[model samples]
Target: MASNPGPLTNWPWQKLGNVKYMVLSPFVANSLYSIMSKEERERDVTILYIYPFFLWRMLHSQLWISFARYQTSKTNHRIVVDKGIEFEQVDRERNWDDHIILSGIIGYIAVMYLPWAARMPMWRWDGLVLTILLHTGPVEFLYYWFHRALHHHFLYSRYHSHHHLSIVTEPITSVTHPFGEIIVYYMLFSIPILAMFCTGTASVSGIVGYITYIDFMNYMGHCNFELVPKWVFNNFPILKYFMYTPSFHSLHHTKFRTNYSLFMPLYDYIYGTMDMSSDKLYETSLKGRKETPDVVHLTHQTTLQSFYHLPPAIASLASKPYSPNWYMWMLWPIPYGFMFLTWVFGSTFTVERNVFDKLRMQTWVIPRFSFHYSSSRQKDAINGLIEKAILEAESEGVKVMSLGLLNQGEIFNGNGELYLQKHPKLKIRIVDGSSLAVAVILHSIPQEAKQVLLIGNLSKVSCAVSKDLCRRGIQVAVACKNDFYKLKLQLPTELCSNLIFSTSHTHKFWLVGDGGVQRDEAQRRALEGTHFIPCSQFPLAKARKDCIYYSTSAMIIPKALQNVYSCENWLPRRVMSAWRVAAIVHALEGWDAHECGDSMLDVEKVWLASLRHGFLPMVAP
Candidate 1:
């Protein structure tokens, strides 16, 4: 019987989790060891002497953890809570490790008693060391070539990502990928040994030892430990000559295409894959470097709370907390009402009477804060005003004028040909992101500039650029609802710290866009602030939303959201985008969310709808 004293008491789930790991560790080790040959059971000298070392290196490599933690500590310059995931992501790919361990053990066992014709012949004593040296170069060279192929256009999705899965790798992660990849490496390394030893031309013991050494080297390389001496780094003109280090390997993991050679730098250099400028190569140790902003660090700090959670020492500045009550539930009803309205408008309204049908297709119109200006006629009127701005800019020196989101080059690409015909000399450099381009412009821009025109997302981009541009005797002009830019300028530094708007002290700005609705806390803050141009006088009309297409299954909504946020391109591919709108239209016409889940776009909608639905259920699970 269980030892629970009362109905209210039970074991904490965390304890069971810890208990599971402890119980499984030895079972796993013993099970693996059982498949390997023991000293007494071994027949060949190679099996007796060298093979054990190979097994040792593989098992130890798999088991190792402290080394990764030590390296992470040195790199981040702080005590790290979890180094395993970081190691897995950086260097040791997940499936690769599983492949190595499983194939090596299974192949060894399966062929252990094969006839002399079938089995790998043992390496002789004399050639054992020599073969290790000779084979190392060839093995590495082959790896470099094969690795390069894996990254080629076709194989990348299936094979390369298995390794790239954990950009930071760990010991267990070292050989833990798909079986085929492991078999590939095995075939490359083992073929020479089998050929040499089969004819009694080479020592089997040396072959086994070489295998062990290579595995050890691979393990240590991914371990991220700076166990090698400082003198080695200082004396060696080329660190790759000594041995491939974590820094050398990590850069390959981070920048996948460069540095494919393993074991030796010769092949990589000869093949044009060697990276000479890796930041990690300069360091004698992983110590004393800025922290890498990887998932592990954030997981430790925010998710796990193991990094260090120091309570704020200062007393609370605000007085009372909001009470949990029925009226508080009223706040939740607003979103439901909005969703209900959307559903009603989308489904109940006839096509001729539908407000959305009045709007033009493939056209950008500014959104207004209130329903008073939500008419399609008002939308058309706003579009005409923006057209006038474009015409005015075209008539003058600003020949390549745009009204909508200019960051998306596609928008410009579609319409840019018209402008190029009008003004051949006008070179418009559209700024997309402050992080990528504006930073360059901020540093590179001439200090003598008098006036600067800023547009779009005042909270993030325009405001950020304006502040930097202002320092160079530049006055900033924003195409926003006058108050949006003006209020941003007036915001307290604390609220707007690290933002360009915080630096601004003026509100004498032109209203170019329709006033923004206070949809969330952020917008509410902007609305209440004194900087905004009044909504009534606000100017421009432009669409804020973009489209997305999901190419995969509709089942992967969470993954879709993650892909949307985590992927390199914020915009979906054109095919995917078209499918997304089509999916929405299908959904509005009484199609079940699942029924529309044929394309990638439907997948995203299903996912988003599920997330939205999670909040709407009246009763808790």
Candidate 2:
């Protein structure tokens, strides 16, 4: 987390505030039936005659189709967890059977009463026309302006930022906003409704049907799950342009600024708001235009060529050497992990005896120690294990260090006093970016040391300390499991060079490295000593006959294991620019024996520029 709360300016839909319009469709329908003329009420075209039948048929069709599929595919009832894991559905008894009977009675009254008043309006089928009009063009045009307004600097901080709460949104989250926000979000919908209503509109039924259809479309579009059949997606290419596909909307959510059109891409195309279209054909072309140039251009093919890579070249040319900057490393978790290892494991890599006179030995002293709160509220037993490493360092002649003040406040001042009472020996000093305070403290020590142990928020003041110490020619080694875990998880795999959050079904070690080589190797060793319950195959274990039990924990292991090799530059030597790693994984896994429907896949070529670097060499060449 950053030192400050997220900026309000970045909230996705913050501008929608304090707007509401009560929708009384059923009331309007009922009133129409009660007040309508006899001829109007007696018309055969009344919705009262057709509405119940249409609804009954639709519901029955959905149920019968769904049930038939469920019987054929035994796993159809499985609820998708994380990654590829699925859970068997359990039957639940329902006591709300009476609600159906009450609903039918209420429905009968509304149907009979509404037709009488609504009969005159039904003559033109204006409701359907209005609904179709809204869906056709106007909505997207309205949405673009509203979306752009939300992004405006003046309005973004307060009114437009709330919708960005979830980086990845689910369909249920589509309309889940503050009550005030929802009104503004749907204000455009009311335009056509109001216009049609005032102009002898027959749009009431059409509007209702339009809303119901759009709800399904929007829900399916936002749903991360694969709902639309692949065959349909493969055959109907134009459908993607008209209907927002999951990938289409997901890309928008991921990028946030482009692709604001909903229901259709027409407005975005006309307005130049469309960031991507299936017509463009290659996904990478879109990303290539958007990704930071420096990041995308970094090549690993020839070490000599990358020696000219500006950032690393500048660092290498420095008259005085220091620990790697590790600034950008934190932005990506997996590379950060490798960088952490590259630092902590420096003792194994860094030249111990060197000709450089500025280099000196130093020892870290901890006057106090405390375990930080882990992602899991439960006490992190791993923290205790890490604390033992600190103690071990102390026994080996290094001082265990503690923070005198956290970024929030003085460590021992308010909450620190009680905390320090438990561990008194650890030194506490107010550390910001100012190195003078730390230097004064370090100078006070008379004994020469080889290493300094840093504890607490290493990325903050500790990062500065490491840079300062390493610049003075000290081998600055950092031991942070949290840092290690985070970096390792984000390291790219051969499948995709870019870092992405590894999808895991299990929540056990989300913030920890459960899949790193060290982590997995530890588990592999532990399994020999004890019978470990493989949770991935049997999450919340039950009697099962199938041998292929999906273990939530095991799924992430592949990515984590992939990280070690990917970071180490082992596999996927070539870059496949337009393909997503997940897409590649799906293709490679052969889980679905379907044909490679995307024949255009071969049209993709590696950017000779993209594969410029073979991976940052683990060693200083």
Candidate 3:
């Protein structure tokens, strides 16, 4: 939204939410019905192509989004350096498809009511030429002045500022304008199509090609990377005036007072509105700089559908917590195809980047899933990937690298200690974040509670929590005799009195780190109002509505944490896993120690460091 909201700022079907796409159902149904009932000679070809074209436009824009995100995440050819895209920008750009709906509505009206549009041929060479000419002559000129008018203080605050909200642009950010502005842009863009209709030269191919050209230029101009090879302009200097590069438009976003042309810099040149720094910025962006992070969080894929939740996948989906959606089942083959690709060519890929004060951070994913770690045949490959990632981080001068999720599983990498054993002189400190995980788990227990049920396989974090609770004089009840024995062996003789074997699940607090099946069984046994605080990295499924389920060991990141648009797997927005935060805190405080394998850091010290560094405990709602 803009500062002073104006009329039609919101989309017409905005209230419809996800179901807004149903607005096109009438047109789609009618087009399909016509195709089925009438022969090819009798059916209107242009009308039949409308729905498919809309889908094509959507796919085209999404491809740009994925491509742009992938390029910006990489160190090469990035135009905007250091700046990160935030969630606010993702949400504002989510409705980029709104223009498709608007165009569909207008196309439906033209095909149904306009005689020339009702009977258009599929292709015409003259029509294509006319569209290019008209767009360059009239459309480009009009848009340049209109764009300048929009930047005026009055209209900028009321509408255009919303589009300008994303200074570090993405592909979709090009179309993320208020509805009122989009309506005017459609009017300006319709000149070529309407001209063709009036001149009796309109063709389906002409219409599709022109709109596609617009989308392509919009994406190319706004994507925050310099992709257009400099050789093109170097050889054909005249083309520099005819076309605008990504860096050319990036200057407009930064300086905000120049380079007002759309796709063409000819007008900006003619009107003397071009920025002087355009060519320099383009050259600098082409020779991209390398970005080395101070801290790295190493994570892995979880469920099959998690591929879609990656930052480079879908913006809206990635911004929210991951969940199994019924719709994802229909696209099941894609995930399998991705898995196959990972198997063939799997390596660490950068998932996200962030900045905290002067500390640069990044999250790199091992191209393996949870189930892959369980397979003995794939264990070596998974560890190899992890080892490769650690070495890569070390080579990049990363101060700290934290192992997240199953990457730190004892059976796999012995809580990330195997690498240290193999390479004892490694400078990059490998952190399992066990200390902070233990702190978060222990802090979650209510002060009034004297007894708590501890049900889970014996992991480093669980054992640490058990020992801490026992030392605090709280009864740590375990249902499994095997787990009880393990806890007794780990704890000191004085703390052994607090560890008791009990099958009772009536405890109000359950410290659960068990697998999904065992956790479900425990939920069934536990009484209503029980609080299930997870000590393990994995979160438990909520089996009972009456019982309260807290998130896995995590913390609400400080407001200063930048570029936290995507959720950390199942955790909510702005929430970081304790392990990830621990690594960050370790870097921030200049802690020169490794917390992995059987070794444990001071839980209290880690907890206080986190608080001092602005990571707050995630209080369960």
Q: How many pairs of residues in model 1 come into backbone collision?
A: 49
Question: For residue 331, what is the lDDT in candidate 3?
Answer: 79
A best-first ranking of the candidates according to their TM-score comes to 3, 1, 2
Please estimate how well model 1 matches the true structure, expressed as its whole-model Cα lDDT: 0.38
Per-residue lDDT for 1-621 in model 2, tens only?
112223321222223221111122454465456446447545534445444544453343333323322221222211221121011000000111112222333334544665432444433565667667765667767776777776666555454454444343344334433333444655665566555555666443554555556556655544443344545647987665566555556556656777777667666667776765433422322222211100000011111221121111221111121223334344355433433553354221110000101211111112111222222332233233324433343343422122111211222223123323344453321111122222222332223433343322323223333444444544333235564354334333331222223222221111111123123333332212122222111122223232111221111112111101111011122111111121222222222221111111111121111112121111100
- What is the Cα root-mean-square deviation between model 2 and the actual structure? 25.5
List residue ranges in candidate 1 displaced over 4 A: 1-58, 73-97, 104-124, 199-205, 236-239, 279-281, 284-287, 290-621
**Model 3 stretches with alpha carbons more than 4 Å out:** 81-83, 516-519
- Model 1, range 329-372, lDDT digits (tens) per residue? 53465434534564344211101000112111111112211231
Report the alpha-carbon TM-score of model 3 versus the true structure. Answer: 0.97
In order, candidate lDDTs are 0.38, 0.33, 0.88
Model 2 is weakest, by summed lDDT over 10 consecutive residues, at 85-94
In candidate 3, what are the lDDT values of residues 158-275, reduced to their tens digit?
Answer: 9999988888998988999989999899999999999999898998888999999999999999999998898998899999989999999999888899999999999999999999
> Which candidate tops TM-score?
3
- How many residue pairs clash in each candidate at the backbone level? 49, 55, 0
